[model samples]
Target: MLLIVVLCAFVVFLLVVGVASFLRSRRDDSDERIRSRLGALAASDADVETVEYLVRRQMSEVPWFNTMLQQMRWAANLSRLVSMAKAPGTPGLYLLLSLTLGLLTGYAVFLLSKMLIAAAVLAGIVGYIPIWWLKRRCTKRMDRFQEQLPEALDLLARALKAGHTFGGGMRMVADEFDEPIGSEFGKTIDEINYGMDSDRALDNLLNRVDCPDLKFFVVSVNIQRETGGNLAEIVGNIARLVRERFKLHGKIKVLSAEGRISALILTLLPFAVAGVLFLLNREYMSLLWTTELGRSMAIGAACSMTLGIVIIRRMIKIKV
Candidate 1:
């Protein structure tokens, strides 16, 4: 019975993965969808064109995985890959490392499996898990940083109101505010002062953040350059809008928290139970882990778990 359950789960997981991949690919057919959303807001044509170009370029680069990754939050992952390749790590080296990890992990899992099919599957899954986890971590960290952006803007507005130049106010925010946001903006300010054009520095900041609100801000600054309005007041209004948007987003997340938690628990419970069983009754669990029947069962279990997770994630994901 235990073997049967595991086999069922694994098969289901495979099917779910297939479906999810298919759906993501289908959705990507309309790259225009994402662009249309951004077009609604007051953004410069140049900025919008740049965003559109990047999106298309990235989509072309990862043709298979880019669409699915939209929900998986992998922008930070992609950015890190770019930054690493440019600096300490070489692109060739990173690819080689991923390949090495994949091969070693794949071989180990293949050796452990009682059946070739299960071994192959497990090896592939294990190999990518580390990279997937790294991507998730980077995404969450970026989100947290973006969350503090409104606060940073508010500080800048206050400083400007107090008769400081825009650059001086930005420096004060960098000095007085906490890290992540402070560090990012401070770097931008530094770049600007070091002879980089303000517009280009601002563009770099927008690329780092890829958020609609920030895009609106950049556009506002450019437009005000020719029109010449109360710049401080405009920033204050942007700050207020960002705060309200964040508040609304928080409310939506709170409402969905229960479902999200339930999904997580459900997805994890089976693996946790399996671990306990292995520790307490090695002999009993060994047949499933070591025999041909056990390998099939493992495959099924993986498939089922994958399906369940995808379904739950879809259910709880509410776009504001």
Candidate 2:
């Protein structure tokens, strides 16, 4: 009788614990959903459905932690580009893999360095270096993509004027022009024919490209759909505006090029001198790697070099 009573008590305890756990999990999931929805609302001025769609699309591409990392990367990248901005890691899984490689490289560099503390400090900076460079490369690519957009729109307009359907014109661009702009438009047309709504298809294109200029292009098209207009004329105007902006930007870049080159030389000179000195007179330079005073000097040199780089970059960046 006592054994039967004890068994019953144990079973009841287990059942109670399981039910509590289940309730807690349910609450946590609900809280997460609410938080995500709030975040979506904050990030975009999109309608609830649109925001939800974007959130789901992003979530599907990356798990939670990775999504957070990519967002952080995007913000950092956007801070640097004064002309056109973009979010990171939307194009390819290669970006995520590059991040992992960067992390490993940082770890290896840390392991190899003699000073554990400095190594760890440098690890984070080094890890982000690859990501920063990748962001720069992507930024340039996106700029080219933006530059091509207005021209492509004009082409579509011309094709339309000649009585070709929108999809047929897009196919022409895809066949005639280079990636990634032509390819992106081609994908949009293909998706539309595959039963996707034009709005949703364009939205997907916007996400894939993730450029502010491209966003403007997509918004323009969607608005034009609801209220009829001479699309070719609108596109031509956009093209003219873009060309003028690019001309101004090109002039600014040319003016700043000499200063940038000078900055590069100044920044690299000290490091080059140090390398030569270390190679030519190891005994004299050994103090730097071996002594605390030398270490302090090394740190100072690094900090000053970093400050100079930042200042030079700021000076050269003339926002249009």
Q: Candidate 2, TM-score vs. the true structure?
A: 0.65
Which digits, one per residue and each the tens of the lDDT, describe model 1 over residues 184-291?
A: 677667766655566777887776654567776788877887789988899899999988988988999999999999998998898799899999999998888677
As a whole number from 0 to 100, the lDDT of residue 46 in candidate 2 is 44
Model 1: lowest-lDDT 10 consecutive positions = 84-93
Q: Model 1's lDDT to the true fold?
A: 0.64
Candidate 2: where are CA atoms >4 Å away? 1-113
**CA lDDT scores, all candidates in order:** 0.64, 0.63
Candidate 2 lDDT over residue span 50-74, tens digit each: 6555544231133553456346656
